[model samples]
Each structure stands twice: as C-alpha cells, then as structure tokens.
Target: MRRYGPALLLVLVGAAILRISAFSALYLRYVQAGLRPYLIVSGAALVLLGIAMAVVRRSADDAHDDDGDPLDHEHGHAHHGPRVAWLLTLPALALLLFPPPALGSYSAEREAAQRAAQGVGVFPALPAGDPVELGVGEFSSRAIYDSGRSLKGRTVRMTGFVTHGDDGTWYVTRLLVSCCAADAGTSKAEIRGADALPADTWITVTGTWHPKGKLGTDAAWPPVLDATSVERVEQPADPYEKR
Candidate 1:
C-alpha cells in the first residue's frame, strides 16, 4: 500500500477532474468553457500515468520479494513519508464528493469598488428589439461609459444573482473572469423599483436605465435599473461572464 500511495493520489485527482470536466458541466464553476478540452486531456494523462506508476512499482516489489528481500527492513525510515503523503488525497476526494459551488453574492460583495473603464466612448448601436438581452457586464459598461447613451429608452434584460449593500441596496450581480474564477471581477446594477430578494437568488430583470450622476464618473458607477419585472430563475450552467 505504501508503495502505491503516490499513484493512488494521482488517480484520485485524475478521476475527480474527469468527473467534473468530461462527465458534466461542473467544470464551468472554476474555468471557462474553452478550457474544458485541456482539462480533459490533463485528466486522462494523470490517470494513465498513475496506472503505469502502480504497475511499475508492483513489478519492482515482486522482484524484491523473489530475491528474499525484506521490503521495509532497509527503508524503514522512508515508510513514514509515504504514510504522511496519504493526507494529500483529501483534496482530491473533496473535489470528487463535494465540488465547490460557483462564485455568488459572497464573492461579489468582497469587491472593494468597481474598476473604472479604460476609455469612455460610444459603443455600437444595439440591435433593434423591444427588450434587449444583455449580460450584466455589458449593461454596466454601456451604462457608465457610453457617451451616446446606448441604453437610454431601451428595455434591457439581465440575469444574475442578487447581492446586498450595507445600506440596504440590492444589485443584480455577475462575476466576469478573464481566464478563470481566480481573476473574477464583479458587475452589477442597482435595482430601483423592485423589492430586494434573498441574497444569491438568481433573477432575470427587465427594466429601463435609470441614469445616475454624470456619465464616466464614479458617482455614475454600478448604474441603475428601474425594473418593471423581476423573476426568480435557476442559475445558469456557466455562471461567469467572459471578461
């Protein structure tokens, strides 16, 4: 068992990765969809490597036994290292049995302040529609930086989890990730006309822009939406917006 400890940890980790990346959409919680293929390949490699390692070690052990050698007599001091190494498999087991949830209100609320846009200008005209479906990040960008007022008079819809401010303010929030969850940024809109729902509740909001402060100013940040309708919805399979 000690001889196979390292190989077992590798297999457990590989199995956990495969469980999320190849067998389900659960990988989206920590990485972008485009990364799924890489993850699948890595998992397969780990599994094969582990199996090969275990086979090689077994062959070596059998050779030692055939020579009438005591397996632990000469390496008794090294045995403790393998025993301690078994603890490394706990993280792999946790990933298999209890994969973590996607970032939600708690992650959003941790943002100290919204980062300012690099530049302010007119964005392309929105497609013609009664209610335009927009990502939370896109809406926030247009609201704060568009000098041409792209969102004005437009009924826009966005879906995100709910988060609350200390002042009793609530927001429709989503996290934006450039590469993965570790680099996530928050985007949200303060809802003006609707009652606050429980934190982390996924909701689709339809509303018109409620202009606040001057465009491109910190005071204009977060933006505002006068929600005519707010309906609870199931969380999306891929929760983070691509940054």
Candidate 2:
C-alpha cells in the first residue's frame, strides 16, 4: 500500500480534474449531480491516504537503519522525487483557470450531423400540423439513405443554418460528416420561394419532400422539399443533433 499510494493519489487527482472541467457534462451523465461532493470527499481521502503511507514508510526506514542516515538519503538523495506527485494537480489547475468553449464550428461538419443510416424505420411518421418537432439530423439521414421510402411524400418541419447557392436560391443545409469539417457532407432539403437569403441564419422550415434535381458543385443526389412556410428562428443551446 505504501509503495503504490502515490499512483493511487495520481488517479484520484486526475478524476477530480476531469470532474471540474468542460468534460464535466460527460462525467455528470454517469455520476449525476453528486459529483462535486464526491470529488471533494474522494480527493481528501486519497491525499490523506498517500500522506499516511509516506509517513509510515519513513518511520519503517528509520527503525531499520543503524547508520543514522536520513530517510530521504535512503530512498535516493533526490528532493524532487516526492514533489513529482504534485504534477497531477496541473489538469485541475488549468481547468480552474481556463475552461474550453462548447463544440462550435469545428464540429459543425461532422458526420454525426447527418442522420444514421440504420434505424430509419424507428422514426415516427410526420404528424399533420402547422409545426412538427422533427429531429433535423435524423430526418436528413433517413432522407439521404432511404430517400424513396422515408420522405417521398412526407412533410417535415426542421430548423438549421441557411446557406446560399449560385442560383440565388438559399439552401437550408446542415453539415453531416464524421469527426469534423474535412469529411462533412451536406444534407440539404430545399426551401423554394424563400427570398432574402441569410447565411448561417437559423430558420424553421415546413415542407413536403420531393425529388427535384442535383444540388451544389458535387452534384450530390438531390432530394428537395417544397416548403409551405419558412421563418427565422433563434439558435438553440444544443444546435446540433444528438445521436
């Protein structure tokens, strides 16, 4: 226990640092709101356990020595060895000083932005109404994968950034790619009769899906939506679709 105490302390400090950082949300999902108190108690316990182990080791070394050598000398005449254990505090200190921002433009183009190819059948059918709560990522993924079956005549209401095209028509597009912008593929459902194009404007669209033609320079498979109405909307806190 004495020999391994410093390693255990390092692990506990690492956990504490992660709990207090931007990755806190990820940990909260597993540990719940009690993480703060848990970190406090666990950190104190580990620190005390480590200190006690070090003290016990020192006492044992003194008892076994007959030459009257210092405990530090017996371990290896290095003052910095014990101090190295404190490096575990660096992550916590950095988080306390500078936390990172939420995932932004960097993650905007990830494939996760697109809908999953599998489980398209599990999505609920669009209900007939003025506004329908459609998961834009899921709807787009389904439309892309099983275009003929999923959205041939189905009406959907979606919200996303508006990007302009060369023809003066604005496309309501969401980037779908794996990881980041480099691999991002666009999943666009057209917005006809929409004027006053606004780049990156968050907008709500109510429309019925129809196969029109090619979209963009890639000449990607075109699955257009004949929009009934379009209105600008405020950006949501979690703008991206959660898989």
Candidate 3:
C-alpha cells in the first residue's frame, strides 16, 4: 500500500477534479466556464497516468517475486516513501467529499480599497424597460463613471450575496474574476431603505440609483441604491461576474 501512495494521490486528486468539473458545475466556484474543458482533460490525464503507474508497479513486483532467490524471499521488500507524503492527500479528499463554497463576504471584505474605472464616459443606452436586470459590476461602473446617467430614473434589479460594513451599512456584493477565484475583485452597491441581511445570504435587490459625489471620484465609489424590495434567493450557478 505504501508503494502505491503516489498513484493513490494522483487518482484522488484527479477524481476530485472530475467531481467538480465533469460531474457538476461546481468548478464555477473557482474558475470561469471557459476553463471547464481544460479541467476535464487534465483530470482524465491524471487518472490515466495514476492507473498506468499502478499497473506498471504491480507488474514489476510480480516479476521480482517470480525470480527472487531463497535468501531474498526471506527478507521483505522495503518501501522508502516518507510517511508524511500521505498528508498530501488530505486536500484532494476534502475537495471530493466537501468542496469549498464560492468566495463570499469575507473575500469581498479583504479588498480594502476598490480599483477605479478608466475614466468617466458615455456608456451605450440600456434596453427600454421599467426594471432592468443588471450585473453588480456593470451597475457599479455606470454609477461611478457614466456621464450619461443611464440609471437615473430606471428601476433596476441586481442579485448578489449580502455583505455588511462598519456602521449599520450593508451591501449587495459580487466578486468579478478575469480567470479564476485567485484573481477575484469585489464590486458592490450600498443599499438604502432596506434592512440588512445576514452575511453571505444571496439576495435580489430592486432599486433605483441614488447618485453620490461627483462622477469619477473616490466619493462616488460603491455607488448607492435606494432599494424598494429585497428578496432572499439561492446563490447562482455561476457566482462571479466577468471582469
């Protein structure tokens, strides 16, 4: 068993990857959808390599046994692998049995300062509607930089996990990722008129924009929403927005 440790570890990690990427949509928690095919291929390759290694090792052991001298038979085959190497499997097992939840309020809060947009400019007109659905990142962009005030009178709906601030302040927050969770950045809107929800709770907020400070300034950051309704909802399949 000890001799097969490396193969076991490989198989376990590969299976965990397959469990998240091929068997379900859980990969979205950590990476973009475009990466699914690569993950699936990687997982399959690991599994195959592990099986090949195990088979080759087993065959070698059998051949060694068949030609062994009487003196050699009296002694046992020694496994020199370090016992600490088994610890490496823990993370694979954890991923297989209990995959971590998507990044939430804690991750959002870690970004103490927000990055500013390029510059204030006119954004394309939004489609004609009463309550337009918007992404938290897009909303933040328009609120902070759009000279056109595209959101001024429109009722908009945005969904994200709730995050609380210092004071009694709370926000509907979304993490934007370019490639994966490691590069995730936070985008959020301060909610007014609605009661704060528990941290990490998913919610759909309907509100109108509440402009702040001059556009293109730090003061306008985070933006503001005068929420008319706050409805708890399940987290989306793909939680992070494209940066």
Candidate 4:
C-alpha cells in the first residue's frame, strides 16, 4: 500500500476530475462549458501520470535497490512512500458522496454583486413574442441598461431560485458566470407579490419589468417584476448562465 502512495494520489485526483466532468451537472456549478475540455485533459494526464509512476516504481523495487537494501534509492536514503498522498482522495470522496447543488437561495440570499455592478452596457434587441422567455442575466441587462425600457409592456418569463433581500424583500435570483463560479455575478428581480414563497424555491415567473430604482443608469437595485404568474419548477440542469 505504501509503495503505491504517489500513484494512488494521482489516480484519485484524476478520478475526481473525471467524476465532476462526467457524472452529473456538478461541473456546471463551478464552471462553464468552455472549461470542460481542459478538465478532461487534465484528468487524463493525471491518470497517465499515475500509471507511469506505478510502472516505474515497480521496475525499481527491491530487485534494483542499491546494496540489496529494500529501500535504498538514488538519493542515498530510504525511499519511504508519500504518506501525505492520502489527502488527495478527500476531494474525490467528498464529490462522490455529495455533488454540490447549484448556486441556490442559501447563497444567493447573501446577495453578491448585483447586475448594476456588472457594468453591463446596451442590451440586445428584445426577442419576438409576448412573454418572451429570457435568461435572468439577459433580463436584468435589458431592464437595467436598455434606454428604451424594452420590458415596460412585454411580459417576460425568468427562472431562478427565490431569495430574500437585505430589506426582507423577496427576489428571484440567478448567478451569472463570465467564466466560472469565482467570477459569478448576480442577476435578480424583486418579486412584488410572491413574497409568500419560501426562500430558495425554484420558480418560473412571468411578469412585466418595473425597476425598483432608476433604470438606464448605474443605481444599484434589483429590477422589479409585477408578477402575473409564478409556477414552482425544477431547478435547471445547469443553474448558471454564461454572460
């Protein structure tokens, strides 16, 4: 067992990486699609490194040790195995036992940077149709940055987790990632009549946009939604949007 320590660590690390990328949508919680290939490459490299190390170690075992000593090696000392390598399995085991849920109300309730802070500029043209369904990030962009106030009369549908604002106001929020979770920005809307819903509940809301504060400027406040309807929905496969 001790002889295989370094190889085992490499294998476990590789396995963990592969698990996140393949087993579930767990990878989506931490990163966007652009990064998936890199993870797979890294995992494969680690696995190959692990296999190579094992082969080399086996080749240089007792048969090749200097002076017929079981542990003597090129460093002129006993080659003890990598005891700390055991720590490598921790992340693998943890991820296997409990793949983390997507960024949810528990975290969004804390409310990081709002869409205003993201410095979004002119929003794109609205889609063609009533109650146009849009991602939370896109919806917030139009509500806050579009000078035309494109959402004034149009009903739009957004899906996100429910959370509470600093003022005990209920909001539907989604985390928008530019690259990964480390850079996630928040997009949220104050739900005018849906405060009764529990925090963290995932829902689809159809509503008209009404800004809580001034729009077309950089004032920090959630976009307002006078909800016409809200329906409980399953959390999306990937809870984040690439901005």
Each candidate structure's TM-score, on Cα atoms with residue i matched to residue i, is: 0.95, 0.47, 0.96, 0.85
Name model 3 segments beyond 4 Å from true: 70-76
| Model 3 lDDT tens row, 17-55 | 999999999999999999999999999999999999899
- Candidate 1's clash total is 0
Off by over 4 Å in 4: 65-77, 81-85, 111-123, 217-220
lDDT of each: 0.91, 0.55, 0.93, 0.76
Question: After superposing candidate 2, which stretches have Cα over 4 Å from the reference?
Answer: 1-68, 71-92, 109-124, 145-155, 160-210, 214-242
By TM-score: ranked, best first: 3, 1, 4, 2
Query: Which candidate has the top score in lDDT?
Result: 3
- Answer with 3 or 4, whichever has the higher TM-score: 3
Q: How displaced is residue 124 in candidate 4, in Å?
A: 4.0
Cα RMSD (Å) per model? 1.7, 7.7, 1.5, 3.1
Writing each residue's lDDT as its tens digit, candidate 4 over 1-243 gives: 677777877887787778888655568888997788888889889889999999987876655664575445555345675677677677766766676667777666565553334444555578889989988877777787677677778989999888876677888888888888887777787888664488778899998887656665556366788888999998887889887
* Pairs that collide, model 4: none
The number of clashing residue pairs in each candidate reads: 0, 3, 0, 0
Predicted candidate 1 versus true structure: per-residue lDDT over 14-96, tens digit per residue: 99999999999999999999999999999999999999999998886676666764555355325535466778999999999
